[model samples]
Each structure stands twice: as C-alpha cells, then as structure tokens.
Target: MTSVTSLPASEQEGARTSPEDPEKLEDPEKATLSTDPSETSLPNNKRVEQPTKINWLLTCVGLYLGALLYGLDTTVAATVQASVYEELGNLQKLPWVGIGFPLGSVAVILLIGKLYDTFEIKWLIIGSVTLFEAGSALCGAAPTSNALIVGRVIAGMGGAGMYIGALNYISIFTTSMQRPIYNALIGLCWGTGAILGPVVGGAFSDSSAKWRWAFYINLPLAAVVSPLYFLNFPRYNPQPEHTALEKFKQIDWLGAFLNASTFVLFILILSFQGPIWRWAAPGSIVLWVLFGLSLISYGLQQTFSILTSPERRLFPIDFLARRTLLLMFFATSSAAAATSVTLYYVPLFFQFTKGDNALEACVRLLPFIVPFVFFVMFSGGLLPVVERYAPWYFPAGVLMIVGGALMYKVSPNTYTAAIYGFEILIAIGTGLVFQTGYAVVAAKVPAHRVAASIGFINIAQIGSICITLAIAGSIFGNLGFVKLEHVLTGYGFTDSELRSALAGSFSPVFQHGDARARKLAIEAVVSTMGTSFALVFVAGAVTLVSAFCMRWEKLGLQTTAGG
Candidate 1:
C-alpha cells in the first residue's frame, strides 16, 4: 500500500478520493469505514427488532377480550327473544332470533379463517369489529322485527370474523408451551359468555330498560377496544415480492361458496320442518334435495382442489382422515346438541310448569351455568394431572346420558333438588367434553389449520343444535294445545275451561290439578318430551362410541406438564 500498487477496478475509484472528502484513507478511523454503499445500506438485524414481550402480552389480552365478545354475542339474543317476540307479537318467528346469529356465524367461520390464512388478519379484525358495533347500534334502534333480524345478521358476520380471527391469531402467536393456557383462555371466554348472557338479558329485561339494550351494550365495549387494537396491534405487511392478486388467486373461493350454500340450505331446510312446513311437505323435500346436492358439490370441490393443487391445499385430506379429529367432532357436536336442547326446553318448563317469570326462569337455570363454569376451570387444572383424555371423555358421556335420563324422569311433583342434580350432571358433562375435544383436535391437526379445524367442529356443533331444536319444536307443535286440551277434557274439566287453562302453557296440565289428572297429563307431556331426551341419550352414546375410536397416543396421551 505504501508503494501505491494498482488497485482492483472496484477499489480504484475509492482510492482516488478527493481532498474535499471528510477524511483520507490514511486515517485509521476513516480506513475502518465501509466505502461500499451496499455494505453500509444493509439492514441491521439487531436494530430492526420484532415486537417486545409487552406488545405480545397486550395483543393476547386484546384477542381474549375479542373472543369474549364473540361468544357473548352468540347467545345473548336467546335470553331476550321472548321479550322481542312479545313486542313484535309474533311467537312463530321467535326461533329466528336465536337461529339467525348462529347460522350466519357458522356459515362464515371457515371462510373467514381461510381468508386470514391468505390475507392480513388485522384489517379483517378491524372491519369485523366495526361491523359488530354498527350491527349492535342498528339492533338497538330497530323499530320492526325485520330490522332487528337484519341487524342480527350483520352482527353475525362480524362475530364469525372475530371468532375465527382470534383463534387463528392465538394459534400463530402462541408456542406449544403456551397453547394450553391460550386455549384455556378461549374456553374461559366462551364459558363466561354463556354464564353472563342469561344474567345480563334477565337484568335488562326485568328493569325498565328495553330488550334492545342487550344489543346496545356491545357498542361501548367495541369503541374502547377498536382504537387500542388499531394502535397497539402490529401491522402484518406481506412481502412485496408476492402481490395481493397472486394471493387472492390461491384462495379456494369455490370451496367457500359451496360450503356457505350447504350450511344455508341445510339450516333453511331444518328450520322449515317444524311449523313452517310439515315433515312430509313437498317444499321440505325440495329443500332437503338442494341441501344434499350442495353437500355433494362441496365435497367434490374439496376433492378436486386436493388433486389439482401444485402446493398442498389449505384443507388437506389427511387432516379430515385423522381419527382423533373425527372423534373430537362427534364429541363436540353431541355436547353442543345436548346444551342446545336443554336451553330450549328448560325455560319453557320453568315458565309453564314452575310458573316462573322470565327473570325467575333464568335464575332457575343457574344450576346448569354455575356447575359449567366450575367444571371448566376445574378441568383446565385437572388436564395437567391426567395423562389421557379418554378418562374424561368416558365420564362425560356417562354423565350426559345419566342427566338426560334423569331429566326425562322430571314430573310436576319432582323435587327441586333432583332437578338441580340433573342439571349439574349435564353441566359437568358439557364442560368436561368441550375443552377436551378442542385439545384433542389441536393435538391431531397441524398448528396452522387449528382455526379451520375449530371452524369445522363448530359447524358440526351448530348443525346438531339446529337439527335438535327443529326436532324438539316439531314434537312440541305436533302435540298441539288443542290435542292436549281434548286429552284433558275427560278429567271433570269442560272443553272451554281446559282450552283457557292450557292456552297459556303446558304447565297447568302438570300442576294445579286433581291428583289422577295431573298424573296422566304429566305422563303424557313426559312421554312426548321423552322422545327428545332419547335423541340426546343417543347422541351421548354415539359420543362414547367415538371416544374409543380416537388414537390416544396421537392425541397427546402423554400430557404436558401444564396442560
């Protein structure tokens, strides 16, 4: 260097630096500096860091809060439906209030989950939350039943996106070590929502507040969370090398369409079967046919996607093939069906049989909700101690079966303690199985597809609920008040008197009657409702059978230290 030897082409330009330059190459500090622009322009790995631990914690808290809102929205409408129906003066349309939210939410869950996979989730969350608040506001202001239904439908869209997005985000953000806690948090949110829905609805309805306040309450919560979410949540910018169009092309839109159609048609058909259309009606038959065709189309599309894709499709056939996932689906579906059946009939029983008002009816249901919350928390703790889920699964099935059988035994004169005990059995069964099923599915499926799997499981669950509710409603309708009145005519009660008494509810048939007449009428109602419980028992038995089909080892039979 001192001899001034010729430099390479690249270095020659730098060596001939002008005197105007800040420093000469002979300077030690200057010599150490990188003259190459590329070297100096390179990104600093240490300087450009990822989100801090505090940011992650905040994100999780936000997601958990979002999940709570999602679950609460699903059932809160149910508690206020009676009031809504009474105000609207259409008891026939009452079921729609409960059905609309779940149907709409279930319809979009898988699609939304897949969208999250293909696109940025943060925007979807923002849009969903905004939609939720708007819907809530609209519902609060609605003057007609149709307007309220529209609001509910809009809210359901938001709920579907929020729920699926939360699950997807949690799955991606949490490590295996954190999954147990993360999943437990989700379970807690759902459980809490289920518990609070009745209480909130009852309180609002019982007070001077209109039933509309139930929908309105969501707005303030949404406003508070939205800004915090926008500020603190990390922006997920996809690498620019891949354009948005290319990403969009990768989504299976056809699959989405078919899946939505299938659910819509299926739910519509199920809804029509009870009072809208007789079981054997031609319109019902056509709906069933349409539902079948849609299902077939959905399956074919999925199959084609799997066969034709260059990369593995989002829904791999192998995931569905997993025995653990299948069993978990059945377990969840049956448990959900049981819960739906209980919720549908219990209030009616309290109102009619027990002569309880709306608030009192809801309070009477505490036996189910209280035990459910307790068992859910208790099971989260016990999961770490138990090595296998099979033990829990078996007991859960037994409890459900026993509960259904005992509930079938309830009569006009049945002791309050017995009724509470039966409710406890149902609650324990539901709580034990629900979280365990999710755990099993998560264990069997790839981590990335957990949201999709959950969506599918929830679809099955909602499907079961819809079908069971329809069947129960059909049974109730078929056993008309007129028929019941005629049956009670020979009990020293005139036809006019019987009609007036039975007009309000099926309860007077059970209570405030001659001993022999009460016994017969109660027997008749029980025998009729027994058919519904029999279906529940059958569902429980199927769950038990499916439990044995799950591969224990594959389902993480070796429990984690903190599961």
Candidate 2:
C-alpha cells in the first residue's frame, strides 16, 4: 500500500506530456515545468536545450560518489576509535574526535543550502570537494589527536555542502519521472557508506599505522568525483544578478548563530551530564535554559521576518507554515533517530550479549544492513506505481515500531534466530522511510530553490540522529553504570575499579575473575541498552503520528513575500 513519493510536478498540474516509464527521463532542456512562465527568466532559445541520456547518467554517478564519501567518512572514523585513543592518550577528550565533524557540518548545513540557491551549484560542489580533500590530507598527516579532530570538522563542513550540492544536481539533471530511481541511488550510496564504514574501518584496526588510510581512502574518491562533476554537470545556473554585498546581506546570521549555539549546548550537556555532572547540576540546567531561550529567539526572528519582510529571514516562515513540510521534518527526524539508534546500539547488543568482537558484531549486522539497502531501492522502484509516499509511511513506521519493540523484548537468553528476525524487520522499515519524506519535500519545493528545501529536511534528519544518540547515550551510561556499580560492589570490586570500568564503557566486568560477577555485568549491560531501544519506539510513534498529518496532494512552495 505504499504511495509514490514524488510524481512529475507536471502530473500534478495536468501538464505531463507523457506517462513514460519511471526509468526514462524527459528531455531536460525541452521540458517545461509546472511553474508560472513568468517565473522562468532564461534567455530565448536557451530553454530548449535537451540533456542527452549520457550526461544524465554521468551526473548520477558523480552524485552517488559524493554521497558515498560522506557515509564512508562517518563510520571509518569510528572504526579507528581504539587506535585513535591509544595514539592520542587523551581518552577524556576523545569524544571531540567524533562530535567535532557533525557539529561543523551542522553549523553550516543550512547556510550551505542557501549558498546553492544564491550561487551556482557547480562552484559549490567544487568548493565542497576541495574542503573534503584538504581535511582528509590533514587527518592523514596529523601528528596529534587535536589535529585529527580539527581535520574532521573541516571535512564535515565540506561534506555537508557536498551532500546538498549533490541532491540539487539530482533534481536538476533528472526530470520528475526519472528522480525516484536516482533518489534510490543516493539512498544506496548513503546506506552502503554507513554499513561499509564499519567494515572498512575494521580493515585498518588491525594495525595502528593502517588507521591513517581511513582518511587517505577518501582522497582518491574525492579526486575522481569533483572534476567529473564540474565537467559533466550542465552549465545551468539560474545565475542571480544580486551584488556580492547584497547576497551577503541576505544571510540570516542571527538565526545561524542561534541554531549552531543551541545544538552545541545540547551536545555538550549530553556528552558530560551523567559522567562529568548530573543532569540537575547547575551547569546542565544553565545550558538547558539557554537552549530554550535560543530556540525562542530563533522562532521570533523568523516570525518577525515573515511579518516585516519575508526576504530577510534565515528560517523561511511561510515555508515552515506548510502542514505537509512540517510533518515531514519531524517525522523524518524521528525515523532518522530510529535508524541511527538501531544501527549503533544494536551492534553493541551483539558484542555485549554474544561476546562478538567489534568486527564480528558489525559483520553480523548484514541481515539488517542488506535488507535496508535493498528495500530503500525497492521503495524508489515502487514509487512510480503508487504515486504517493504517505501510505507507505505508516507501514514503514509500524515496522520500525514493531522491530524496536521486539528488540526491547530481548533478554540475555534471546535466541539467535529471533535477533536476526528483529534486525531484518528494522532494516526493512528504515528502507521504506529513509528517503520518503525528503522525496516529498524535494517534490514540493520551488524548482529554483530545491537545494535549500532539501537542506532543511536533511538538517532535521542529521540533527535527530545526533540528538537521539545523545539522549539514549546519556540514559545508557547513567543506567548501566548504576546497575554495573551495584553488581560489582556485590562482587567486592573496589570503588576505583568501578570508576575505571565506567570510563572504559564497563566492558571489564565481563573479564572479571568471578564468573557470577561477569554474568551479572552482561545482564546489566543488556538492560541498559534495552532502555535506549525505548527511544527508538518513541521515535517510531512520532513518525506514525506525523504520517497521517502529511498532505497527500502537491504542496505549495510555501513562498515568502520577497521570494
């Protein structure tokens, strides 16, 4: 019963010239979209240029490579964690190595989207690739952990921009009829990168020197893709005539600062709350309060722009007003959180409960990862037949909920078959929902500004992943530590030993002299990780609620006055 994620805008407007195969694209140059003719400002005769099939195919390959790099970077860094810890010897600061990249990407993600709308997509793609290469080179050559962390941040900033730029090209290079297949391609690259990150990262973890290759590998990929993008992508910039100063003035710095600062505050609090300071501590409380205030200020800023002058807003008020867009943002956010949680903590479950090594645990996740990759591709293929995303949203979300509930029900003795079944269910659900909302958003946004619209949805998706990780992480740490401490104390383990175990993620208890203590420790770890699955359930429920709220029809572009 899944619905099509995006139909030809032409179909919605009764302007579709052909109900062609979804695999086929209309002549990009000859295709006139559903928008007002006055809105098109292209010079005479320029509008009729058709993109040959070969150009479109190359463009898809280029965009897929771009997506793969980002996903690959994310997991590869994690796979090298232990080597990084040993090399740096500053275990306390290690969180920054991972957190820095996402923060840097988040800081500029929305801003980067706006850049695409205001500037040429080609230059932005080129700039993003340059940043990625520079960062990778820095990391490969880093002499200290601090240097590596900084390199990750720089790389992330570029990755975010590149990701947005890639999506923008997908929309432009392909007609609506052709978009779903390519959307599936993007999803495949992203999902494969995620799953492959661990596999590839594991390859280097066997030796300390090999860790550098984790960063170095991205270099060749970036080299191949960037030039291909510039040369192959059409010279199709809307080419705004606004002055440099004028374009700069259009940025909503106040909103940007608020958004970045608020997220930073949240990340810091989550990172240290239970381990370094209790949640109710004055520092945590102050940060939480400031976060609330920052959000309020951001809301007010957008509202003021909407009423006074819409063109100046950092957050587009009118666009946010659309009911479908709003639901998609939060719904996808929940779904993203669910996928992140399942991919991450589920593996932890395998390692803790089954005593699998990191590599083994990750490899065993094939049941989940394989279905995820295929089903996402399946969802795209099915879109042409269904013509709507809403109906599919419910079943996908329900599977997520069911999958999560099954995982939550697992005990220390849960059978291997049951675990595999649960993982498969979750992966299938993730496949169905992963790109559904974004496809809807891309379809609904004005063709001219698709980059920003897609960017905003991506922000929600990535932000949800991080935020859910933080919340689930905090709860897992607090609860696991509490249980592990009690169990270890009963086994006569010293307080210093307990503190050390907490810092080391409580894996030592499984290696203790007493078999009884080790058993108790495993149970404690499983219980704590189970609580995190509850967050997945909550996220699934959120998506389920949001699915019904999304409009089934073509949405307005939600334009502001200046737009």
Candidate 3:
C-alpha cells in the first residue's frame, strides 16, 4: 500500500481505485503512519484514523444492536401468532403480521441505500434508530391486528436502514483484511438474534406480559446502546458541497415508486390468490395486472429516467447485471427463502404435531439454532483464511437439499428424534451462506459503489423473505383449511372456524372436537406443512445452480490507510 503522507494534499484526501482492477487487495493490519488530517475521508476516497480500541468496541456494540434488531424482528412474530390471535380475532389478516415488516423494508430499502452515499451517515443512523424504536413501542401498545401490522411495517422500514447501516459501518471503518472477521461477527449477532427471536417471543407470550412484551423488550436495549452511535461513529459525507435539499433531490422518486408498487402488488396477489379469492377472480386479476405494469414501468424508468442520473438511481441496475453479481443475487435469494421459511414453520410444526404451547414449541428449535449459529461464524471465519467464497455454497446447497427432502417426508407419524436431527442439516446449510454475500459484494464492486452493491444484494435477501413467506403463508393457511374442511365435513365447522384454527392451535373448535376429529386435524396440518417444505427443497436446488455458476477466485480486500 502507498503511504498517504507522501502524496499531495488533494491526492491524499481523494485516493481511490477503480472497479476494473483485476487483483484483489488484502489488509496488512498496519497502523496509520500519517498524522495529516486529509488522510481521513469517505469510504470512496481516503480512510480516517482508527479510534481507540475501547471506542471502536463501543461503536461496534452500537452497530451490532441494529443487526440484532433486524434479525429479531424477522421471526419474533412466529411464535406469538397464537397469543396474538387470541387477543385480536381477525385471523383472516394473519399473514399481514409477518408480511408487514419485510414489505416496509423492501419498499424503502433502495432509497435508503442511495441516501447513505448522498448524506452524512451519522444523522441517517440516528434517524433510522429512532424510527425502529418508535415502531417497537407502537407494536407493544397495539390494540388490534391492523395496528400491530402497521407497527411491523414501520419497524421493517427502519430495519432496512439499520441493516444497510451495519454493512456500511464495517465498510468505512475496517480494513479489507479485517472485514471478513468483523462481517462474520455481525453475522454471528444476526443469526443469534434470528434463532432467538421465536424463543423470546414464546417466553413473553407464555408469561403475564403476553406477546406485547416481545416488542417492548427492544426499547430498553436500544436506549442502552444508542449513545454509542452518537458518540463514536466516524463522519462520512460524500458530497459536502451539496445542501441537504439538493441531496434529497437526487433521489429517483419515479423508480422508487415503481419498485415499491411492483413488490406490494406481487405480494398482494400471492396473499389473496387461491386463499381469499379464486385465481380467476377480478380482484386477483387486477392485482396481477398492476404488478406486471409496475414491474415494466420500473424497468423503463430505471433505464431512461430523466429525473435522476444513473449514479443517483435507487438500484445499481447496470452494475448488478455483471455475471458474478447476478449469480450472487440468485444464490442469496434462495438462501434467504430457505432460511425464512424454515424459521417460520419449525415452531409451528412442533406446536401442531406435539400439542406444545408457544414456549415449548419454540424451545424445541435448539437443534436447528445451535448448529446454525455455530456454522454461520464458521463460514465467515473460513472465507477470509481460504479467500474462496464459491466453494462454501456446495456443502450449504447439499445439506439444505438433503434436509429439505427429509423434512418434506416428515409426517405426523415421524419420530420427534428424527425431526430434530433433520433440522441440523438445513441449519448448517443456511448459516453457511447467510451473510457471506455482503462480503463478496463489497469485494466485487468499486470502492465508491460498495454501498450500492451491498444494498442490491440485500434487495434479494429481504425481498425473498417477504415474497416466500407470503407464498408459504398462503399455502399453509389455504391448503390446511381445505384439508381440514374435507376431514371435518358434517362436523359442522364454518369457514371462519377453520381459518381461526389454522392461525393458532388454541381455537375453540379444536377443543370442542372429538378425539377422532383432533386426530384428523393433526394429519391435515402435518400434510400441509410437509407441502410447504417443498419450497425449501426447490430453494436448495436453485442454490446449487448458483454455486456451480460462481467464479472460483480468491476474494481480496482493498482499503485506504486507516482501513
């Protein structure tokens, strides 16, 4: 690496390498030798001095809190469904509870990505944290199902910012060589929070505070870590000369609107089609048409938008069109779908098949969670030393395929021991690739385009979770209802009764049913759940295609002086 002090002031403050460089760079772990203030700048240019070890540690804590919250919110509602259904009886809108968060995230995430590059990162972080905390409070205090869903959407929007911010912080503050370690650590926190979400939700639901405290718990932790963000974060302003209003004007509003509407319409179609309305119904047809139109408009607008330059577009449209990055996006989407569907259904499986309460059902997931947490760190650690990102996906894909196949065969008759064992394979598989894609994107893009590249990959990650969960929910709810109706024919259950039973095991109809009726209901649920796992099987298969398509190359890091 060149010494910053030897360069002229202008060069020292704005040194950068283009994305076309063939050789990958790595960190030497050297201390900054220059005392010049110009050495410190934005990630696209120069890096600043390192904070004291204690100060960096505090900053990391603040950053990891965002990651934790992002992961926690992903599945906290999984185990709380029954408790929520009991308190708020609109079981018809149940999928919205899970869909709301990811919807909010996918809608605004692209804009948030562009904002990080255009404005000072510190204020954005503060604003995002404030939104997340406020949303958490609203969720805890919500009086109805609709209110709860609205709160979740707000939290998801904030979470989209925080998720990108976590990666953004690591990108700016650390050396490329050190990034693998730090990125792996963030993955550790995120995976831990993800698996623990259901456990915490279950615990809260079983206690006197009920499901509401599941959200309330975030407030105290956010309060504790927020000061670190304010005090320790490095300032980054890419365009200091531009006013805030000018920066805001650079956003591609048309592209953003089209992107958001496209996603919203697609999810609506999935949520309603074949469940609430027939596929040929006018309502479904209208949603499908709007979704297609929105998608077409987004593409056209992105390609020829007069409102914003290519640099200011919400998505890194041309950049991600590159072969390697495109493969990464597909692989990432599959991995995300596999993980989200598994996490959402595992607890529900135990609850339905074993007659377990929310707490017991969630606790039963340790088999999957334990290995998942371990291997996520393992993959992150291994990637840096080996410097090979592609091969890791092989084992991940194989394990997920095998696990998904085994899980798909799981009936109500399957042994509990076997079910527990089957989960480990999928857990190990998913944990291997969950966050590694971010590191790869950072390595692949130009220094200035790292934020946009990472955000684009995240679009796949968050979008898959939203789309797959909506599809999976539709499958589970509708299929299970049909099967239950067939079995309980002449038992005199209404459509609402069947739908309520699908939402939670605590429905009064289930209690009123005879032993024969209960037995048939369990069969219906297990079979429907087994069908849902087929999506996991397909995800694993698609992941293998990505793994084989990836380039077998070492991922080298590039960093400025302090970095």
Candidate 4:
C-alpha cells in the first residue's frame, strides 16, 4: 500500500540495470524492479543492486519495530486511562488522553506526507524515531495530566511518520511483486502490536513499575531496533534539482495549517459535543463553527490558493478525481472504523459481563487476535498470486457483518465459546482487508504519488479510530446511563452513581451493589454495548457497498524477468 521515489536518469545512468541482465539475486525468484522507462526515477525509488538476504531482513526488522511502536501506542492509552486517572485525579479529562495521540497524527499527516516526498527519507525516519522516543520519555516522567497529554500528542506525531515510513521503506526495498507480502508483514507487526497494547499496559499496571512502563517500554525497543536504520537505510534525494532551502520554501505552510486546524476542530467537536458539553453549548457551537470555517478554507486552499500547486499542496486532491481512488479512500476508512470499533468494545464486553480486569479482558481476546493476524498474513501473501484485489472485500464485508451481528446479540449469559466464535469471525473479516488499501494504492497509483497516497489512506485509518471511538464512547455512555436508570430506578441510585457504574463491573457502584442490582446493571451494560456494536455492523455495510462499486481490476504486479 505504499511506495518510494528516486533520482533522475541522468544521475543514475550507471546504476540502471537492463531487465534482460541475468544477474543472480540472493533469492532466485526475486528480481530488481527498474524505474518506469517513461517516468523519471525519484529519490526513494532509485534502483539499486539487490541487498543480501541478511541486510533485507535487518531492514525489515527495523521497519517493523517502527510500526510496532505506532500500533502499541495507539491503544495502550485505553488500558492506562483508569490508572492515569487514579494517579492524576482528573476523571473528567480522561477522553483527551486517547484523543491527543490520533489528533496529533491527523493534524499533521498530510504535511508529513509532503515532507517524505521532499526530504531525505532516512534522516526523516531518524528524526521521527527520536521525536517518538523523546515523547515517550516525557510521558513516562510526566508530573501533570496536561504534560502527559502533550507527550501523547508528540508521540502520535512521531508515530505517524514512523508508520508511513515503514510503508515507504518496503516500497523502496521490494519490487511490486514482493510488496504485497511485505506490506502484509507490516500489518502483521502493526496488528500484533495493537492487539498486545492493552495486554502489555495491563501487565505493567498490575506490576511494581506500574503504568509508566507502557511509555518507557518504547525506549529499550528503539535502542535495539534503530541501529539498522542508521546503518542500512538508503540515502537519496528523488528531486535532486530542488535544493533543501528551495524545497522548504515550496511547502504549502498555509495549507498545512488550515488542514491541521480542520482536523483538530472536528476531533474536538466530536470529543466534546455529547459527553462533556451540550450540543448547543457555546463551547461546542464554537467548535462546530470553527470546524466549518477551517474545512471550507482548506477546500478553497486546495482548489484556488496561489500558494498551492501540484507539487506543494499537502493533500493529493487530484487523486480524488479518479473513481477508483475515491472508492478506495472511503473503503479504507470504513474498514478501519469497523476494525477499531470491534477491537475496542470486544474487551469492554468481557470487562462488564465477566467482571474481568484489563489484563483478563485482553487475555480473552486472543481468539480474535490470533485469527486476525493469521488472515492478515494469509491475504497479503495471497494477493500477489491471486492478482485480484477488488473481490477480496466482498467476503470480508460479509464476515464482518455476520460477526458484528452475532456480537450485537451478546449478553451476560452468553457462553465463552460463543463469544470467542463471534470474535473469530470479526477478526478474520478485518484482517483480510486491513492492509489491502496500501497494496491497492501502491499498485493503482502513479509511482510519484505513492508516499502521499499512503499518507492519505493513513489519515483515514488513524482519523477513523479517533472519530469512531469518540462516537462509540458517546453512544455507550449515554445509552448505558439511560438503561441503568430504567433498570435500577427502584434501587434509588443517584445519577453520579449510575454514571460511575458505567465505568465497568469494577466500579464502586457495581462492586458494592447487591447481587440483583449487579445482575441488572450488567444486563443494561450488555444492551448498551449491543447498540455500540451496531456501529461496526454499519461500518461493514459501508465497506460492502464501497467494494461492490469498485471495478474488478487486476493489480499489475511484475513477477517475471524484465517484468
């Protein structure tokens, strides 16, 4: 799903290899991909002699480590929230802890994409890793809630770059023929990290070192993995004509600012409107107005700003004109939304219904994670050989819809085996298409736009998590509160007590309640969770619809000699 750029032909004439050249690569089946004859070789795409198997493996490890950090940090905050709230004493501000990281990524994603296109990628990746580690350090040592939020934002910013850089690295190092499997492997790393995030966080929360290790853990991992980047990552400028200062001056700063403002306002509106502020509250209304203005301004800037051009604009608005690209964009968004909402609430299902702690809830989720990881690998490896990308989504969507519906019916009495079965269905569905977008865009788009296109899809993936989580939170909290009142009215519980109980079965209200009251509360939580699962069902439907409309085109992967 991602790609690279390369140097001009005039500078790279000596490095170019004819397709007919019978050079023996380390892998007999592996062939070096040449730059397109009709197109200029850009920075990241410069053809080079194939690396030894060891070098290739090490670079992949380095890239996967970057991806693992992003994925681990993504949901680790969810598990740490209760611990952080207990220590920091700001239960009201808990939502921001999760929002801060993705907000940072969404705000700057397009700008980061442009930077990758313009800068030396290895140094950019180095800078990204350094920023991520620095932010993690800040998070580990934070004295105040605000500082922790800031650290999360910083980490998210850095994590986005590292994540997208992984895709670009694959695109640079592998041929189109080899990219699907590699991209899938990146997904494997990312999915495994995300699935383990809460587990690791919970383990740490239950340990002597406690929640800070969730952030501190990244430091040691980076120390072990980053040396490969410094030593093995290739260095080149795709746009050799542009001096660093010239490229810097050409960046659309105003467009980037407006784009960042648009996402920040929109995320704020979603985060605050239902839970913290009334929809009509001045705070919420101001956010809505600012979001509107920022969105309109960004659209105008993309279309008509004197400062913007094909080369300088942060977003790939031109790609939107293509039907395939547009479909892929929304499909990727829907798939990500479906996957995130499912992953998030499945744990909550156990926490409420089975009275499990974070670690226990996570432990119960292995049924889902194992199948999802396997299918992600399976689908990625299958894509190149099968040569068809469009048809894969149909079955995936159906499985998700079926899986989501089954989960929506989950209750306090649901059997452990049944819950695991439903989760397996959803996991298989999601894993099939999770990394497909990258491979599709990598094959479908022009080589030059690979980095930007990857960033564009990434915004969908990360932004959907923030947006869907906010909406899902509102739905779960409000609906559960209403249900609790209806069910527990005879018990004389206060609104505050009802709200606290919605935290989970571990809350003081639930933990202290009589057996009957605890049973009723669990039932209400289960019902509200069912409503929340409807979001995933709807997301699956959207994916189905989008995929149905897509053209059945084969991904043109060159596998043979000279191909």
Q: Which is superior by TM-score, 1 or 4?
A: 4
Model 1 CA deviation exceeding 4 Å by range: 1-51, 235-241, 306-317, 384-387, 479-530, 554-563
Question: Tens digit of lDDT per residue, candidate 3, span 1-563?
Answer: 11122223453332234333434222211111122324321333333434666777777888887888888998898888788888887777778878888898999888888888788887898899889888889999999998998999999999888888888878776656567667877877877887888999999999998999999998999988887887776566666778999988888888888888998898888888755788899998888888889898888888876577777878788755577778788878888888888888988988888888888998888998899888888887777678788998898888889889998888888999898888898998888888788778766655667788778888988998899998889899878888999988998888888777777677756788888888888888888888888888888888888899888887654322332
Evaluate all candidate structures by whole-model CA lDDT and list the values in order.
0.63, 0.68, 0.79, 0.77
Q: Which regions of candidate 4 fall more than 4 Å away from where they truly are?
A: 1-53, 490-494, 558-563
* TM-score, per-candidate, Cα-based: 0.80, 0.85, 0.92, 0.89
Task: Give lDDT: candidate 3, residue 376.
Answer: 81
Best by TM-score: 3
Please report how far candidate 2 places residue 43 from its true position, in Å: 11
* Model 3: CA > 4 A from native: 1-16, 19-50, 557-563
Evaluate residue 351 in candidate 1 and report its C-alpha lDDT on the 0 to 100 scale: 57
Stretches > 4 Å off in candidate 2: 1-52, 141-144, 207-209, 306-309, 490-513, 552-563
lDDT of 1 by residue, 177-279 (tens): 3454566677777767755665577667667996888889988887777765776654443222457898777777777677778877876775566446777
Ranking by lDDT: 3, 4, 2, 1
The C-alpha RMSD of each candidate to the native structure, in angstroms, is 13.3, 7.6, 4.8, 6.0
Shift in Å, residue 254, candidate 3? 1.4
Candidate 3 matches the true fold with a TM-score of 0.92
Greater TM-score among 2 and 4 belongs to 4
The order by descending TM-score is 3, 4, 2, 1
When 2 and 3 are scored with TM-score, the better candidate is 3
Give the per-residue lDDT digits (tens) of candidate 2, residues 197-231.
76676576654547788788888877766667766
